[model samples]
Target: MQGSYKDKEGEEFWEEIHEVSTNFTLFLIFLHIVGVTMSSRLHNENLVKSMVTGKKNLNN
Candidate 1:
């Protein structure tokens, strides 16, 4: 907050960098959901429940 970018180039630079950052964050979230779903189906487990309880069954 102590400094400001006075040039158009700086604005464009930050915009592009943060755009990639946003996309990467979204991709990570998508992967997390897919991984949880896959684990639930493949292992016969309720992953959401386990997350809530902070425990997983041995059979799972």
Candidate 2:
């Protein structure tokens, strides 16, 4: 009976895993914002160019 259920370090292990998961989620959110901003800017630029020249840039 010297080493029963109370002799484990489960709490500390779970805490570390939770912290790492939170940090990874935050990083993914940041990357998503950056990508969306860039894509919107590019789309707007192409639209403006097409309006001025009366021709669509199919390469975009």
Candidate 3:
């Protein structure tokens, strides 16, 4: 986190970027979880299992 004082008005800029990026990442993760839940329920399929197995049963 150490940076020169000239790095855009001291470390405040970096701190702001870090905070926004972290919050954005967490938001994306939350959206992904909600998406997966809705998709699994709608499709009536084990999406996580298919992800781990790398394939899904086409018959279904």
Tell me, by lDDT, which candidate is best. Answer: 1
Q: By lDDT, highest first, what's the ranking?
A: 1, 3, 2
Candidate 2 residue-wise lDDT, 1-60, digit = tens: 655565456666888899999999999999986876687587754554566699876664
Clashing pairs in 2: none
User: Per-candidate TM vs. native?
Assistant: 0.77, 0.58, 0.75
Candidate 3 TM-score, true structure as reference:
0.75
Candidate 3: give the clashing pairs.
Answer: none
Clash count, candidate 2: 0
Model 3 deviation from native, Cα RMSD in Å:
3.9
Which stretches of candidate 3 lie above 4 Å from their native place?
1-9
Best by TM-score: 1
For each candidate in the order shown, give its overall lDDT on alpha carbons. 0.90, 0.75, 0.88
- Tens-place lDDT per residue, model 1, 9-59, is 688899999999999999999999999999899989998999999998886
Which 10 residues in a row give candidate 2 its minimum summed lDDT?
Answer: 43-52
Which residue ranges in model 1 land beyond 4 Å of their true spot? 1-6
Query: How does candidate 2 score on lDDT?
Result: 0.75
